[model samples]
Target: MTFRPLLALLMALSVTVTASAQSAADLGASKPRKESTLPLLPTASEADAALISAHLLTRFHYDAQPLDDAMSQKIYTLYFKLLDGEKVFFTQQDMAKFAQDKDKFGNAIWNKDLSAPFDVFNQYVLRAIDRMNYARGLLKQGFDFNTNDTYNVDRKNADWPKDQAELNDLWRKRTMNDWLRLKLAGKSDDEIRKTLDKRYAGYIDRVKQLDSEDAFQTFMTAYANSTDPHTDYLGPREAENFDIQMKLSLEGIGAVLQARDDYTQIRELVPAGPASKSGKVHVGDLVLGVGQGATGPIVDVVGWRLDDVVNLIRGKKDTTVRLEIVPADQGQDGKHEMISLVRQKVAIEEQAAKKKVIEVTDGGVTRKIGVIELPMFYSDFGARSEGDKNFKSATRDVAKLLGELKAEGVQGVVMDLRNNGGGSLYEANELTGLFIDQGPVVQVRDARGQVQVQGDDDPGMAWSGPLAVLVNRGTASASEIFSAAIQDYSRGLVIGTPTFGKGTVQTLIDLDRFASDPTTKPNYGALKMTVQEFFRINGGSTQLRGVTPDISYPNNGDEKDFGESTYDNALPWTQIAPADYKPVADMKAYLTQLDQLHDARGAKSPAWQLMLDELAQYKKLSDRTTISLNFAQRETERKQLDALQADFRARHKAIDGADSAQADADAQLDDGLNPSERSLKTELKEQADAKKAPDPQLQETAHILFDAVGLINANPKLAAEVLPYGGKQGNSASMAAVAGATPLPTQNSAGQSGGASRAPAAASSSGH
Candidate 1:
């Protein structure tokens, strides 16, 4: 399939490269390090090859090109960036040696040779070992907190050190800064030294653990990213993790785990899961140690492999596991707590759509707004393929929720798509069908310039009342498509900041499934390649420019650091001819008044003000790349940050009640678990009817919807202002005239590359 070519729409996102084609010179260049005399790492074999990437990209990539020197340049730069992101390990001399073979990467990869990249990586490992040893040695020398020095935490744009002396100097300040940070955290000299020693040792061990598969995956990622940021390859172990995530079910604590610096952090709490229900463990909590059951010595999980930590946390249902957690976002001090939890199956129902009705009063009239939180655009593809009519899906659940809302006499409905990183593409179409009559929802264009319009065929409308879609930076891919379609059709008002602009679709192909050698084990892993680009019915691609809410709120994510625009290789945004359809109404006509009402209401909300203040402080810290190493200076800064945090928490407490009850309950639950079957009842009863924190964003959106209802009720014609082609052609008496932006590119949508053509999925097809 092909796609239309228009001017670049979005800013670049990011890239990476790979290694082989061994030489005597390369073998001789390998240097042993004193940090750790690890066993010789295994090398890649043909059976675990990456020939699939070259073959698939040339055959199916949206912008397929020959493996040539031009592409190799990108791979070269990307590989180095991946290996030494902070430019702390490799020196200028090291970079010069790698630069010589920059353009040869493509030819080597295409010919199944990887010696060059591997040799480069070997050098990197030695350099890293040397640096890590240097940092570790610093822990023995007591640091003087009175020294006035600063460490640049972000060195992506910094120059590579010229020699060992220059690199050593950089490491000195970095070590000092680390020492100062720990000191300010109230760590004693002995404790500080031990923690730093362990951290550096962990780094060395992690490097020693690297094998050929790990190296290949990293290089392959760089190679794939040379084309697009989304295209990627997952090794055998990574592939297993991916599958578990897609299924939204795992035999673990049900906490989203992420590697943050040197610690494994709980990124989020999955509702109904052991963690969330425990109410003891919250997001931003870091796992420092893990223990089996409620007894025995706890093993330090800090600096441990993410998968290993996950394994430690997982067990059979009713089994007990203990976690030593350090509360994050509280203070930098090394305070910690121990919590015990009984493991259970993390089922999909825990993440299903949930509904709550909130009453909002506007002009003395109370309006009940039904809110549905959609965590993901999930679907039971396995069940659906088996022809199960009762299969679970986001669309089906939401449709049922809409019906119930109607029964409850809700004046409006708010679909909360916050932090929802989209899933099923088919669900986006089906969900849009619930709000509007049959019409085109999204458009898809392939590499061959063929455009395919994906529309809703279902005529049944679940709810035709006032509606709003709430989104944030985390809402992406399928979520973007659904929201864009709703906006194009003018069926609902979108509220919140711009979303994550991910307009491309990916197709995962299991290379093992199609291997020619029957004797080969089915473990070649998988390749997720970008196959198509999606467009809204109004002819705009949500590539780099995400869906803009009709009424926006105070943004917590800065455009410079977050969203598609932050990526250096993200697909550009463009436009095509608007899809042939008529909008249900001109929702844009009420945007001005809605904005006014939103501002007026927000001015009176202490919660909104507190959120803004916190956001501002977050941005300030995020923008700083350098940190002072002086103990006094660092302590003052920490104090200021603590003040901001304390004030914010205080304001939150005043509005949302103290967390004393929740804390007490958490302590009770942690101590109550019996590590056996009898522990289940206590665990289950603790959070059976727990009340969730009120959502300020949803409440704000409800008020905005109330304003929308008030305007529409005052002038009913405004609700029937049929604007054709998303208000591009002309405006009606009820609609205002606004100049249209660039139209989406019109081209044939077919996946054609290397003189090959292939059928493409529907435009709204999701690559989840």
Candidate 2:
């Protein structure tokens, strides 16, 4: 049951990551062969699933096995489609070879050993190629169907795909109609080839015309991404260039490209990536053409698939490769617009993190709030603790950031975790420790329900002050861990809609590790199995339900659309006994009032109003089955929406003259009154005023912490020896926030750390 180190699985099946040696025979036909000559391959249905499962684990970095062939089939087919066909590229000859082979390789490959012929391995190899080719072609010719590239990652770290019908069509029609168009255009085969060449020049500026590339990549990305959230299969050299692998040490235009529908489109333009350095390319640019050297006619590659297109763009570093692009959001009728860009080596420094400071007027005082965006929770797991390593750990960096923010006299801090696609688990635990005093932040229960509690090693909190943690739906896995802990401990006010659940843990299990003999399949693909589930200390599982709303915000993610919580047969929500513990403070009595206040202001606030309208629209389009088939009506609806948005944006932008009303508020301030603040000028003023209450969300959190502190103060005996200063924390029962006045981390002027505290505060639970 135990697969040694899953590290190989982690590094296995990486895109553009070529295997040691894959001979033509290895990638060739899979026909009947004598099984007794070597090791026996799994032939039984059950055995097939196990073998396939093993392969999946090896590739996807999963730690579990499939129960049957059906399960393996579902996973394999789904993954194949997700991968935008498959990784191995083959030509028509390859397909024909497999088709003609009949059954020469081995019985295991065939579904029917006793009947005609069914070598799935060989058949799929060819089919996968066709699929990839088709996917590529579709990207070139713009898609004609409505496609949705959606994934669901819930709190438990599980993911599933949505919009299957359109997705399937996107895959199927990717290659068809191309040669037919050339034939119908009455162009000779040679003539068509020549046209293809001249059209290549048209791509220099249109390289950003990534319409096709984006679709295919998005379509297939779910395959690789669906795996352990890592271990992608890079189809061509273009994929490798975009991977940003420092270890490989290749240099080229710093642009990431993917096959969306037909063309190779840019996924992101690294800030200093050669493409960006040229000042000609931008993220979301669609590449329609390319030019190899200095200056010439741009290649007009309007309908080429990604592989062929990428092959044309590939070149050495410092070589001036011209690119063509249609900037994002600039297409009208999807016309072939063009702009040119040069290629250059992408600098690594540009990919590093950046920080910003925002000031929000609270309680009539302008306080600086620091914002740090983490793209990935990356940390060099290989060279840590045991080696002399200068590793980049999100936790360590964040701890340092807290110090800097505190020194800047920032009263409240907001940890922006939006779009943080997750990284190391150790880093997640360590990051949570920076805010919490440190304990078992999360529990990892394996497939058999064996739980391993992950705790913090650090005793010092980087910052303990009024804090706000911001999240959107994209926050997942390890991300969910930190957020879940904060909520369970009532550490911070959870804002935004529900997060991407994705709480399930996956471990890559390589079959090569279990092979009794090495002669069989030396190295098979990996499997990304769901091996463990994460649970919060409060007993609530951060599984399919994900993190619930504390203070909801209008965000770009569809709350009900994406995230693991929306998947079928996902793990259910459950909880274990609450671990014996205490938090910084409680805000029960405060939450009620705060919620009421938020409800009131939220109704009046334009932001919330707009969000409500958006949510209503979302409700209407909750399911495609429910949508009208009337195309005319849909167009009319689109027009109406465009007009509505235009008006809102216009009015909001012109709020200047419309809001000479601010003059009234300024006049009130001149009369010894402040009107710009969301709440009262002071505690005294708040107590006196019947109106102008603080936001319910903020008030609720503050009041909870305030009351929790008071409760502890009133029952000083409860904190007696542990009140002001406590000894080292022992078990869960005695666990409390690190005690001391290292500036009670607070998100408010009153110094209430969002989730961490100077001392363990009283605990209060409320329902409703």
Candidate 3:
């Protein structure tokens, strides 16, 4: 079924120029009638909704439940969440009016009727405009920042305001809080006003920028999310962007951009990309203007749309593009730092698996432990599918690294999968194959409830020695699979915090291919549908309850908001029959000894103690959902936190001594700054060593591996238990797991360049 263009839907709906004259509806109650003056935004027609609804019910995995009245109400409820996540926009009465058609959503969607959703969007636009006007007026009427009012930063769970009056009061405090935050940041009153004025203006522009396509995508996603979180609709452009991200090789500057007010901010640098390698551009830098090669007139992109700015920046390889950037450290003084860059095919190789050997002393004997940091499980699928002999994939790269490590006589291996958000499913399976001789790696259950066992039967093992997998809350999806399989096989010890718990597999389907009409113009787009759930060979699923580490450290990230458990409609974890497999050895008792060793070592280490304290403070800050509007109170809190942070850095630096400056410089480089520029400021050693420092997690994992090596050596019998299954049966496979040098993009509120877009859905897959 070829999905129609959003414009078609818009045309079918009343055009703004053609809208009939009608009476104005009060902002207060009085149901929005068809004749209301509110400009109706374009939305899915009954035909559009019916086709999508059919696709969801018939083609989606898990036999996606029927679109009944209950689902309709869910879709309606989710729409509000997506539009006004903070619960600060829509009022109680507005919700009540929208609720009248709550159950009608499913039916309307089934019929391809988008009147209700469109009508609601129109009302939202009106409300937003009204609020924006109120906010602009307040910018002129500055208030006392010394007021004792506290503005809640997060209002996701708060009740909607009863009326405009209540909302005005809330916005008043909110405005004060915004102003105070800037004041505390050291901005002058005049500067603060300009910054906020631009910010608020940018917000208004964003609202106004919403077109028929935005509405269709937003509402459709909400509807799809009611069925499952992973399922989402991406517009044609968004779909292309998704492809670019997944491929991790884009023909651009190789810098991830995020919209911040009227500016496109450089969030991070893709390692090895032209911009990163040049070492001139830094993260947190803002692009104020763009110019073509050599002396092309610089186009001020300050108020340009994000996509428009992106288009201006992106060009063919070898092309020169100059950017006027605002230094990251420089507050919004509007000063520009101009830099020129030649565009290239920036491969995200930096995030790729990298190998390093660290020496750890245990029992007065130093063991050379190899560490392989696999950022994201990625693969050059195009090359692999073409049967290229030198296909680049996570598995292939790691296998090569294993050989090098073994050649180097490393006694143990630590696979650092920390912050790996996961990627190719095929790579995950193949990576697992490198460690194990053979066995089912993961179980895949489709919409029909049929389970397909995906396994690696490669007999040629790669350095099957003492192993450890380092993870954190950012580890997820394919990374979780690899770790879980390792844990199930008793192949390695998993370390770090609980993972992000994303086990479901998503397949991007081109909606235009499914269109009923073969010759439709402007193909609708693509749908990323969660088609299957991944289960461990041992019958446990790694859905919401992500693969828990065998050993853990102090977790500072907000777990409530970070993991899959945060989603309300995520698939519940479920279990199935276990695959035929035998573990190398039971490590439960061994883990106890390892944990004790870690604790004892941690207790004596000041660096470790400092990290724990820092984490505690971080968690305290993260848990806060509100801040005082009083400038003095906020300022005092900020100073205290800053003092504590400074002290921690000092202690940390003291601990590193000679390596401190280099480490600090490298840490600063993470924001995409030029290492040379930063190095000039610090008394750092060579730039090469600057990037290498004492990684607590890697250190801890190496130590644990040393202990594992000791235990295995003490019990020679356990070491002798060799792989039993193999035969070269094949398949390809699959967190903050690393973006490996290709630094995967980060997402934020203002349309980040990369990362999976979230829909309104949550829950856990049922599993062990």
Top candidate (lDDT) = 1
Candidate 2 lDDT (Cα, whole model)? 0.44
Residue-level lDDT tens digits of model 3 in 1-768: 012223233222211111001111121222212122446455333246346545665556563777788888888888887777667777888788778998887766666677788888777766776777788789887888766888888786899999878899988987787777667667677876776776566456656655666667767778767777666677765666665545545577777665555566775577777788878888768788887788877777775555556667766777778889888888568577889988877666666789998888866877778899988876656554576555556766787777677666676789998888877776677678776665778888887888977776544455445678998888888889989999998877888999888778877667777666778643577766677888998998888888888898878776877777877787888899998888854667577888998999999978788778867876887788887888788778878866666676678787777466445544432221122122222323444464565567678788887776666556645444321121111111000111001112211111111111212012122111
Ranking by TM-score: 3, 1, 2
Residue-level lDDT for 417 in candidate 2: 71
* lDDT-based ranking: 1, 3, 2
* Model 3 error, position 477 (Å): 2.0
Model 3: lDDT of residue 368:
74
lDDT of each: 0.67, 0.44, 0.66
The 10 consecutive residues of candidate 2 with the worst lDDT sum are 759-768
How do the residues 1-768 of candidate 2 rate in per-residue lDDT, one tens digit apiece? 011111122112111121111011121221211111211123333233234443554433333333244433343333333322322233334344434333222232234231112233333323433444445444454422233322221212222213334334434432223322343335455654444333322222123222222222232223334333332332223233323321122345656565333344565555655566656565556677766667755765555544344555555555555667676556422555544444443344322344555555434534355566665555433334345234444655666666666656554456667666565565666677766665678777655667767665445455554445667787777777888887766666566567776666654344345554656654432333455667787777766676775766655536554666555435567777665555654434245544665667667756456446645655554533322223344345556765665554444334424333233232222111112111212322433332332223333233333333333334545433322123122211122222112243332221121222322111100000
Predicted structure 3: lDDT: 0.66
Give the best candidate by TM-score: 3
Give the backbone clash total of model 1: 46
lDDT of 3 at 107: 68
* Total backbone collisions for each predicted model: 46, 135, 63
